[model samples]
Target: MALAFEGKVAAITGGASGIGLATGRALLEGGATVVLVDRDKAALDRLTAELGKNCLAQVTDLLDAESCDAMVPEILERTGRIDILHCNAGSYIGGDLSETNPATIDRMLNLNVNAVMKNVHAVIPHMTERGSGDILVTCSVAGHSAIPWEPVYSASKWAMTSFVQIMRRQMLPHGVRVGQVSPGPVASALLADWPEENLRKAKEAGALLDPSEVADAAIFALSRPRNVTIRDMVVLPSTFDI
Candidate 1:
């Protein structure tokens, strides 16, 4: 079977583990060369070893503007072109707004909001110059609705969702596609940061998605024909009610 991403180059941030790593594997199986970017050097090395030669690991802190700016250029220097940019790097700070300290808040916004925008800003020109590309984001279901447990996290996702909507239109004329996968309750490290009670509830209810499921959504969006765009897909566990 022919895969849509065969011969393409995909750059996925947070690609060391969880949803990002799963997505990288899918892309590799489909014959795409992958560049895996994450902050953990040890994990990046392990993932690169696991994924083999076709996969490259880049240890970077997306919060660093200069580092973010250098990502696409470095990839292009190695691969000659970047066909897909999956903005999947983000953090979840769960708790009441009042409980989130100033540093935590800053870290959350820098990675979740600023880094995404900066990466997009770096890649759009390259994509547009070539007159085609795909930019997919790993959003959350919380972006579509209010999540009472994590107000600031919800705000960050809402911001990203809005960015995808507006950027899709902006890139339409350039033949670039912008889309997002909004997954609900994925059983990943993101959940590890949540309040103990919230995590317990999610686990007990069995309302959790596998990281591979989110990868499936990403591959679907990237595989679409140039004329078609799978703008927003919300993947939730069967038992997920809200």
Candidate 2:
């Protein structure tokens, strides 16, 4: 049977690369009108060109609440309605708490946690008014398992996972569905600067999960019948323990 996403409208943060880019492409292929939000203007432009008119790119720093507020209205004006929101913009700075600077911690919180919350808050009222919507957040497996080297990143993701759980409970009555995807490792720019040795080790350890796999899972969750809600999904390489 054909997928049910045809004619839907979606907004995705961090749509310039990695899992976000993969998810956006999947949505577009499924016949959804997609809006790509990212801070990287060049990458956004390239993606917009590649995805064509069905995909609109909005360049904005999601770290700032005001910018996020502006983006919501622009998307509404363009799409007329938003059926799905994929909170996929995030960053990973690896270090122990003692070695991590306050600025780094702040940036992690702002980009990974606060920004997702702000976007959800901004779009939720409209969803509530419509009495139906779906929200999918790109949390990480780190949220479920601790990583000593990336404590702050894990903490932020854990917070996001918690928020999704709470929001799912609260929004269910309003016909809103909230879910999270926790991906293991993806072959994306997020690993672009990793030490060659570490990269090799991760690969050898079989910890790499494809971004397309995660995107497929997101599409699956969002495509579930309205009566079926997927609360949380974990997508990881079979070789990894966590």
Candidate 3:
């Protein structure tokens, strides 16, 4: 029999667009009630309305730990339990390191790395107490190998990869599964900051993946048997190299 989420509750950050929204759609179809967390209030309202009653919207800024902490309790208030957490909120910084603004680097690191850590910290204990939960971080192929065009972005993802591994080990004993979905270039706003040349190169090379494909990967991991975990998965455009 296949896995199902008939009564599961999932909260996804960056849920206003891209992979987060796509993943929320998939979970809703699988019978899981989803909370779409995003900083954009308008987008959240629109998306939540589109997703219908199975989905709720929580306007939040993941960059703030307090905002991250508030999501768990809010979900509990409405749904009574949190069965899954997809830390899908993240940003991408592209281009040469010399040309990169240090401040931009700091902001990216906060969203991509620190925010993930904080969200996990806030939710893990609740999951442990319940004796089960799943944490899925949205990582990147940049984490697997160094990309010259976006060194700092790669570093943040590398940090997430490390965090996922460590969390997986630590959470396993407590019945919480931690994993990551590392994708190659996707046609997302994250790529909005990419240097024109790199974006053109990736487009010309057919290296841009669709957000829905990554969503499918997430659903697969989430559907695994309780005793089994998919761990880490990398989804890339077939033509994308490095």
- Which candidate should be chosen as best, given lDDT against the real structure? 1
Decoy 1 TM-score against native: 0.97
State candidate 2's TM-score.
Answer: 0.95
Ranking of candidates on TM-score, top first: 1, 3, 2
Better of 2 and 3 by lDDT: 3
How many clashes in candidate 1?
0
Best by TM-score: 1
Candidate 3: clashing pairs of residues: none
Q: What is the lDDT of candidate 1?
A: 0.91
lDDT of 2: 0.88
- What range of 10 consecutive residues in model 2 has the weakest lDDT sum? 190-199
Model 3 spans > 4 angstroms off: 1-3
Residue pairs with backbone overlap in model 2: none
Q: What are the clashing pairs of model 1?
A: none
